[model samples]
Target: MSAEIKQAKCIAVLGTGSDVGKSVIATALCRIFSDRGYKVAPYKAQNMSNNSGVTPEGLEMGRAQIVQAEAARIAPHVDMNPVLLKPVTQIGSQVVLLGKVHKDLSAAQYHREKEKLWDTACGALDRLRAPNDVVVLEGAGSCAEVNLMARDIVNLKMAAYAKAPVILTADIDRGGVFAQIVGTLACLNKAEQDLIAGFVINRFRGDIALFKEGVEWIKKKTGKPVFGVLPWINHHIPNEDSVVIERPEAKTDPVKTPTVLVVRTPHISNFTDFDALFQVGGLAVDFVEHPIDLSAYKAIILPGSKSTRSDLFWLVKTGWASKIQAYVKNGGHVLGICGGYQMLGTKVRDPEGLEGPPGDTDGLGLLLLETVLKAPKTTTISRFEWDGIPGLGYEIHMGRTAGADRIALGKKSNDGLLRVKERNQQACTEFDGAVANSGRVMGTYMHGFFDSVPILKKWLSLLGLNELEPPEFCGPQGRDRQYDTLARHFEKYVDVAAIVKVTNID
Candidate 1:
């Protein structure tokens, strides 16, 4: 038989360390390539994360890949995330199959499954490249980990399989950018090192002119192009930190004399959920570190938390539970979402101790319901509405609530429990049998609840906050436009054309 050859033009984006802006840069590159009219796709072979998203096909994958695909203007594929590990316990994770939790396995067991995942990852890349000009693959953590080099699906193996060029990015802001780049290359095997085409120094704050010597030194040592020395700009981009968005530039408007005391629990997920209320017309918002007098704030918002049981335990330990109950008794508004929703119930059953489980435990006794942590989390995007209020948003969680069915406030969700359903139904109209109680407290499992600008404005107007206005921050083009703006900013210093030429793609 004649030898078969695959011509899949791809590139691997590797970072010196975690949170070094690899995701942002990858997204930016996707936008840049897509803007040039290329059929481009983004891929990540494996991801270990708790923040996840539901794809169009009612499956789940790392939320990062979803954001990247959006930047690429393509629908998310399970192949992008061939192997996903969502932490179910401290030492174990739920292995996801194409975006749905397939099995619960420990770290050891999952590592053993990497070889199988390589096939899946390679398949995804092939499919993506079939109709595309390029596939931008993002690597996980540091590619320099010698021990992990063998099992690595992201950098070395992915580069070899896709036969793609590589760009190693080092965070100058983290210091020792030189050492990171040089050390990484030094640690890699001959073949791995050969794959790297060049290096880029990201998140460079202060004067670039002053860093000329440093850049030159790196170029001389590595014998590669210094693609760019990007400066830090306060871009109000939606962050990858699902737990929190960068606190809005420390508002100077008198702190708004927060009328609501929002408790920011450790391990808080979906903190961005309340950005609307913070940006609400007249309502003042302040975060309380340790439980303080709740009598001042008009409402208490319990945002989503990653470790609900652990956070609830913290609330109990810090006496916030009693204080919250007292505030509610005094007619204060209390709200919860997702894990927070689970906390407002009667009891939380974690019989498997998947979430620090020894047994079931009682809740704050606010709502007459019970939550059970079960296999296969409920992750979905749907439109839900209260009997009298409008709703729009997505849902992500691992617990199911029971009891108080009649007392539930909204309509049953047309969507599945943990995946995005078809768009035949409007957003925020499917309530999943949960609705707003016209009493002292209200709760639901919805994430991104305030994304609907009009709905949020209406909700805030009902609370007598009429002065708040949503920022028309981006142009009508949404994130793509903003990404281009960022790209243009990078282009000022980066060899934008050279990067494309090096990759030999659009």
Candidate 2:
């Protein structure tokens, strides 16, 4: 909306393959530009992932955009991510258009509506570009997937649309970095190939001097410059994708390491809620799909699910429900967040069939609440308190939930978990989440609760794990520090001058 930033240029960070660090690269550039005193924003026309976040306006968007906006030191908006596809089934996804739920569309039906979606994407891009000096664009998956190329509006096609210069990123640690870079160029026609300005080699392991030949070979093969070879980063960034949960896991021991278990549901969303645990030392987190012996872990956490009912059935079918119950019966701690919070109650009713079939599904019965799926999803950046300690988090869910006794009145009781002071940037007094009389079983709809030091410390104290202490650099300030570190890392290897040259901004 500022006249000063109307002259924004696009710089696309496309990938040679999925998980090639496109999002991370874009995030770094956004910070680098912002530190230089330019107003920068991030844009991704469409994103397909279960991971997402709510904007300050209480609208839904991809979590990656939210992270980038934080790096740029601005409030997140829907235009930064116009279309978000949260896959609910193998063939279908819940389409969120311009920050509101559009509809559930199958793959075939979504493609049929591509023409309209393309218009919406372009409009969002124009609106985003109107208010910044530079808008860093991030591409999804491979930019040169020939089969999906014709229908793909995310990668090369989008770059061509904005006349944005592309910097293709490849994961050298995955092997075949040369093939990934050269083969991508080979697949592109002249016009499409010309859009790409250069390359950024990501996750390069071992000595950089050893890979000089590899860089030169890529440059000679494609007649393009190798912008940088980023060494393997020991530093942590947010989740690249949910596929990371599938990595091999080690055994948990409440006695040895104070480990915790996160039930890995098939439709898990917003697993980034626990990303902080990895940063602060002394604690370990693991995602487990199958029912495991729960006695070894200090606590069990149920994360958010895109389909609450579907994942509820999975909990029962997979015997995880019983396993969790047994863990709670033994006085071990258990916490559920978001959809996982919905699953902790007695029953989940969906008479409108908002999430698939219309029916009632039994919950894990750990809490005294019940949930009914309803219209106009609750998406808010919330400010709340626990035991007089202030905390910040977001609420993104559907329907209403309350104590079974209070269900008739349709009101959440004062006995609920946190005291909410504000939602969606508006002030109001209300109670959120539920807790059992035993206090061992706790459930809340709030995501990122652990980001608050008081809430995290309180949870640890409640679990009687006095030995575990959260690190000081684990909050927003810590995150900002990490962004600076990331910018410094990229600046060391990547050619920022060359990037600015390509953007025509210098």
Candidate 3:
């Protein structure tokens, strides 16, 4: 290390378990520090998530880092999230090294390359630290996994490397708050224990005052401070993990409300695509795993998938395909995004065995479209318009679709659903997506389709749900509001001043 060169004071937010509000806490801290006039950056050495996003530089990174960057009021960069592991199968994941596709590897295969990944992660962290006043580092899953601790690049190992103060965040809402904290500490050595400056009890429900003794006990037992007990808040903040969608019943009942059924495919990817729709009042969004009566729902959304072919097979096996086809026949609207969009065609060909074995699978044949799964995944920030109603979104797909415009259905809105004006910040007149069967069936390669208020409103009008719609922003401004809300929530409950002091940053 150079004498004059200084690295940013890093704060490591490690979790007791996955989805323990680590990402949200890190995001809140990012906004809090940034608001205090510090140049704050969020870093995650590696993130295993199907929920990923494209950066302004046209690079792919975990969406969690993107959310934290937005909270910090900075443009998201690839360095913020250097390594992303997107799960394609139960045992295999498509490794994305520094914002580019690397290779698909199984669990054992991935661990073998951990050494190289660790070095890259460290280099990226050093770069991020060099220019920032403070960097908020987030950990993946439980930090005290004894078996995998040696190869852990994003948790305790990374925290120790940066010499950062770790805030061990535990979820109280899941119960066993004491066991969660104490058991985690029992697994770590004294040196690792010293790195943990304090704790944050996340998702604490009911009266926080009642938990004062609980906090005191944690401090007494561990000899470390309990910084705060974060309240259980149900906010519009988007989740970066697929775990949120695991319980399909979390949202309102599809049968009772004017609901939208999102077919929960086994390999569902980018599940956050429908968060905007979930916010609309008087409307419910339900992820139904099994086939159901589609007569009550206004629309059906087939979301993006990691294994499109596999999920397609599941759709058929689970009887969802027949139900969807019947729904479409009964004048139901079906909109597919990304991999889902690829499945709405007449046939899908994978000659090079990219998606699976080199073969052909018959699509739903809802449109005059055929697709070929190819290499070099399309990941770009896109600007487009739906019938002149402009919108902004991104694309991440591995298939090329051939929608024949010559063969059109009479008296139906056929062909491209979006007229693209630009892609990857470059100007080009291009049409994307396909629509057929009287505008009831539409498919687009673009994600974040509902983020644009105008486009959302237009769709609502088409579905006759415009009158029941609620007001909520979905882009940068909307996210900023949520960030501010989160910061405020933390400030109200947590000891913000003490956290700053722990960082020791001037």
lDDT (10s digit) by residue, model 2, range 198-284: 999999878899988888888888899999999977655575485547552445565678788898898999988987776656888
lDDT per residue (tens digit) for residues 192-235 in model 1: 88989888788888888999999899889988888888888655
Please, what is the whole-model Cα lDDT of each candidate in the order they appear? 0.71, 0.88, 0.88
TM-score, per-candidate, Cα-based: 0.84, 0.97, 0.96
Q: In candidate 3, what are the lDDT values of residues 302-394, reduced to their tens digit?
A: 999888888888888888888888899999899999988878888887888987799988888887787777788889999999999989999
How much lDDT does candidate 1 score?
A: 0.71
Worst 10 residues of 2 by lDDT: 242-251
Cα-based RMSD of candidate 2: 2.1
| Residue ranges of candidate 3 with Cα displaced over 4 Å | 1-3, 249-255, 404-415
Root-mean-square deviation (CA) per prediction:
4.5, 2.1, 2.9
Model 2: residues >4 Å from true position, as ranges? 1-6, 248-255
Model 3: lDDT to the true structure: 0.88
Clashes of 2: 0
